[model samples]
Target: MFLTFFEPPADGWHVRRDDLLDRLSREWPDARLVPSAEMGKSEMRDVGWTYDSSEETVECWSAQSGDGISLDGDEGMVVQFVSWFRRLVPREIDVTFCDDMYSFSLMIPPGSSPGDVLRMYSETA
Candidate 1:
C-alpha cells in the first residue's frame, strides 16, 4: 500500500519534496521516494486510486516497496509520518491511501485529525 500526501494550493503548508525525502530517509532508513517510473505500472494501481498522477505533481511513498519495508508496515509508518508532519505543519494537508491494483482507495481530508485518519485506515484494513 501507499500513502500519498498532497499540499493544498497556497495553503502555506507546502512540503518540500527533497526535505521530506531526506527527513524520512533519516528518520526511517527504510523509507524512500516512490519513483515516478514505477508509478505507471498496472501494479501501481494497488493503491486503489481511480486517478492517475502521472500528469500532476504528487508525492507518493510506499510502505511496502521493498528495501526492508512491507505492506504490513503501513499503519505504523503512516501514523509516524502523520504525527511528524502535524508537528511541522499546522495547516491541513490531504492524504490518500490506496493499493497498486486500484482495488481500494480512501482519501483523508485536510480537515481530518490523526485519529480520524487512523479510523479510516482501519476501515481499509
Candidate 2:
C-alpha cells in the first residue's frame, strides 16, 4: 500500500527497519506490517504492507507493485491516512508509487503533503 523513497544522507544514513516500525506503531496504533511470502532464493525480499483494519486501509504491497503508498477505504479515511503518513517522512523524501502509469505513478515531490498529493492524483485520475 505504501512505498517510501528518500535519498540517503551523504554519509549513508538510512532509516532502521525497527525504528520505522516503532514509529508507525506509535503514530498509527492500528497500522500493522504484515510480511509476504518468499518462495525461493530468487524471490523478492523485504516485502510487506501496512494494514490498518480500523480504517480498512493498506499500503506498500509486498509484491513491489510500486504504488508507493496506497489507501483503500472511504475518501475521508484515505485522506486521513495519507496525512498521517506524510508527517513521518522528512522533507527530503518522496513517498510515491510508480507502477500504474495512468493513475498511480506520481512522484509526489516534497513540500506538498501526501494528502494534497493524493487529492491531486485522484482529481486527475
Highest TM-score model number: 2
Q: Write the per-residue lDDT of candidate 1 for residues 22-123, one digit (tens) a residue.
A: 666676554444554655664322221111223322233432221111132345445445445444333544445455465666665555665776777678
Best by lDDT: 2
TM-score of each: 0.40, 0.55
lDDT of 1 at 98: 56
lDDT comparing candidate 1 with the true structure: 0.45
User: Once superposed on the true structure, which residue ranges of model 2 sit more than 4 Å away at CA?
Assistant: 1-4, 7-9, 36-44, 47-50, 53-55, 59-86, 100-104, 109-114
What is the Cα-based TM-score of model 1? 0.40
The residue-level lDDT of candidate 1 at 68 comes to 15
